[model samples]
Target: MASYYLWRSKFGGLSVPEAKRLKELETENGRLKKLLAEQVLENEVIKEALRKKW
Candidate 1:
């Protein structure tokens, strides 16, 4: 995609280690986001179930 190319160009000057670190951080960020989303969904389900009980 054009946006991807544009982003790559912006980071083209990064050293190999910098690029590797960036990738690691991105992966961790994605994992944390997924975990947060799952927790939110579970909370919503629990709330709904409690509402029905009362």
Candidate 2:
């Protein structure tokens, strides 16, 4: 449970642009985390491939 005023103030004194930016950053962060996980999996696959080839 959250209060609107508190949320808005945290986003920057009740500014719409600030709220939007916060949401955008959150979304970007989520995407980056997902990408990182994918890259880790890819790295493991590459490592296994190298181990077999060399």
Candidate 3:
């Protein structure tokens, strides 16, 4: 119990609303990263296709 409280205080533990917002932000970040990665892969494929000789 003491250790928990100490850790919480050291990290400035989030309240309910803050925690919820943090979770939402994390989810959105993950989604955006996935989209960006897909886009990068598509771009690489296109570049490779263009670079091929006839």
Candidate models: Cα lDDT each:
0.94, 0.86, 0.86
Please tell me which model should have the higher TM-score, number 2 or number 3: 3
- Location of the lowest summed lDDT over 10 successive residues in candidate 3: 7-16
**Number of clashes recorded per candidate:** 0, 0, 0
Cα distance off (Å), candidate 3, residue 12: 6.5
TM-score of 1: 0.82
Give the CA lDDT, 0 to 100, for residue 9 in model 2. Answer: 59
Model 3 RMSD to the real structure? Answer: 3.7
lDDT of 1 by residue, 6-38 (tens): 978967889989988998999999999999999
> Model 1 Cα displacement at 16 (Å)?
0.4
A best-first ranking of the candidates according to their TM-score comes to: 1, 3, 2
Decoy 2 TM-score against native: 0.65
* lDDT (tens digit, per residue) of candidate 2 on 1-54: 368667755764636886788889999999999999999999999999999999
Better of 1 and 2 by TM-score: 1
Clashes of 2: 0
